[model samples]
Target: MYSLLFYLALRDAWNLGAIDPTSGTATLLEVTRVLGDMYSKGFRPRRSLMFCSWGAEEYGLVGSIEYVQEYVKVLGARVVSYLNLDVAVSGNYTIRSTASPLLVDAIIEASKMVPSAYDSPEQTVYDKWKKVRWNNVTNEPIIGNGLGSGSDYLGFDQLAGSSNFDASYTFNPADHGNLGSYPLYHTSYEVFSMVKKFVDPEFQAHRALGQFTGVLALILCETPVLPFNVNRYTSALRQTIDSFKTNDSTMFDLLRSATNDFGIAAEEFVARSKSMDVKNPYVIRAYNDQLLQLERAFLNPLGQGGAYSDMK
Candidate 1:
């Protein structure tokens, strides 16, 4: 999936003659091609698979938002997990995975099965020098911030209530700078050879990513236990309510009431979840159904108004 997205983004960028800073049309086209290929290959079974190549992602994930609004019910019923990989290939070996605790544990366990890959000693020396220079000038740590819809993961996460993960590696700070670590990014130079050399030398990082993703897919396909953590959901709700309270007290009250109700529901779910036997099909179905409903209860109908409004 990462490779397909990468190729599509790159190809679209090339066809456009230059990057469309506003709409990212070229990027979206590439994504569409990838989805089309997957469909042609019969990758989706009886299950409903959504292949989204969101447009105007650079303008803040508009394409994805529109999609979610149009198909909330279908997404709610089937989207057990949403995995996002954006800018998957980079010059570093650091793998970062972001998700809820249940999903995070699954990713960690899967990543461990893949061997660690690192930059060469010479590359490390250059990275150290660049980091020092940036810190000396900005007085800020050079950390790659968590994922936002600089890619397509935003709508799925914030709107659909789907369990999601975004994974990437950090290598050269140069990649993020105006200088040309990724010289071809938004330019004509983002060709296959350039990616092979500067972006993912030795391909070990790419291989590790494949292994990690494959393991994750296998787990999602096979696991009888639908890993949902109510404690985390409650904490997140509290934080969201606190953040929004300064704007409207009525909204705050509504959120608080909802939070309390959700807490009660969560407790019920936890009890039921803990008691379920992994080997029982009926127990698994019941647990998964409840988990799905618990997520749906938090949906705000007037918020995003997508098919998966339960997520909002």
Candidate 2:
């Protein structure tokens, strides 16, 4: 249940012009406008499109968690991914994301398609994102591969066992003393004036975000072969395994071997996906199902350490 005091506080804030647009309103505007624009243009997606707005998200993601818990079986089996946009435009600096490794390629592709809000017309979101955080080894923008307990994507990621994506066009943390979020987050000072004057003065960031999100959604819905990077998961797993500081050499070696084998299998899977018959509806459905259910295969039905909420 939502806290009474919190509701009163929010109402008081709203009366004083403290609109919590970043929390969800901005995203709602973006997603809705994109869908409306698509409809106006007579574009129809091959797959279904669903828009979700959950209540009490600030109250520990209460709404989304309950919904996922109720539909976990169906979502786990049929849902391809969850794209979250909470705090859509807290800053005008650059895009930040925490997503399942499977979606890294699709996200990058979408970024490349959307022009950056702050840069020259030729510069794209991918350019700005790569400039902000580059991986020296891979020469690519460093997108996070893990999700923390923060937004609505948590339920879809852990409970529904679906690949999920959460993103924001955020401010530079270096300028804000490396705070976890923007300065006026959930504060009375988070008014429309503040966003207009300081955060996104021209509203270009909002438009860019809408385009990027829309393109990503289209990629997920229209691609004949699911644009999942299965091989990327192998590297993610290897990195996670290597990050452990345990002195257990034997255990580490075993983990490395397993990761290596997983990489080989992932390579095979990618090859098969590339060579599959996309014209046959049954073949396409089965191939897509394999991609969709790969993340679910990692879930432990009983949960992590016997804690049901921690399953992933």
Candidate 3:
């Protein structure tokens, strides 16, 4: 179902002449985890698993968008979630877990299991992630920010309206704050040297990234009650909208009222969903399907143009 015509973008075909930016570390780690999961866990998932290697991500998410277009119906019906693994070792941030409401808890839990990029084995990835997040954004470690259109994640989220997210161990001063990114991006200069020497000198970040990815993926597939936080989403939305009450009191007041009502409903929904019977496969399927369709409610039916759309 892939669109061959869209697969080979002209720039990628000509400029892509060296090794991957990850230097094979992310791929190798993924392989190791997959083999381990199969052997140790023995395919205990309530649903089938999938691993995707998208080809034309840089070309406006061509590969993933086409794949989702191909499998939209089946994916919507059966897929529990989508976790993206791109730019595995971006910088050296311990972990930056940003996702839809349903995935925030799973991401945080997985982070607690992996080693921190900081010192001490006792300090888990979640500790570092929360510290970084707090230093940058809020007082507490909140599951903040919905995924926006940028990479392959766009396909699963914007196009397919699937519960999705992307994680990476990166928070370079250059990319966000006072520093600037490596000028070699999208060029031959964007080689292993930059990633190893500047981005992730120790390469432990790559392993941490892999562990986080594997854990979150397994949780989605195996957990009887999907690790989504409807209340968190509602709460965050309320907090965010509350910031601009002065702009237009009428509309802002209306929004406040709506989100507050939604928050109450979300709390009840979370309790009900979590209380489901774990032993009943039929109940799990029904509950999982509800989680899958939840994302589609946010899709703007007219959101069809540009890299930065209104959908996400």
Best by TM-score: 2
Model 2 residue 73 CA deviation (Å) reads 1.6
All candidates in order of TM-score, best leading = 2, 3, 1
Better of 1 and 3 by TM-score: 3
Better of 2 and 3 by lDDT: 2
Ranking by lDDT: 2, 3, 1
For all candidates in order, the CA lDDT equals: 0.52, 0.74, 0.62
Candidate whose lDDT is highest: 2
Candidate 2, residue 114: CA error in Å? 0.5
Model 2 alpha-carbon drift over 4 Å, by segment:
1-23, 303-312
Please say which candidate is ahead in TM-score: 2 or 3.
Answer: 2
Off by over 4 Å in 1: 1-11, 14-67, 119-148, 172-184, 235-268, 305-312
| Tens-digit lDDT string for candidate 2 (1-312) | 000000110111222233343434555555677677988999877666667766766667787878777877767766777777667777788888778899999999999999998889999999987788779898888889878677677777777777778777888989989988766766777888988899889988778877787788888877877788999899899878878887776778877998899899999988887787878888988877787778888877775456564333
Question: Which residue pairs clash in candidate 1?
Answer: 69-306, 72-307, 72-308, 73-307, 299-310
Per-residue error (Å), model 3, residue 22: 3.2
RMSD of 2: 5.6
At residue 255, candidate 3 shows an lDDT of 74
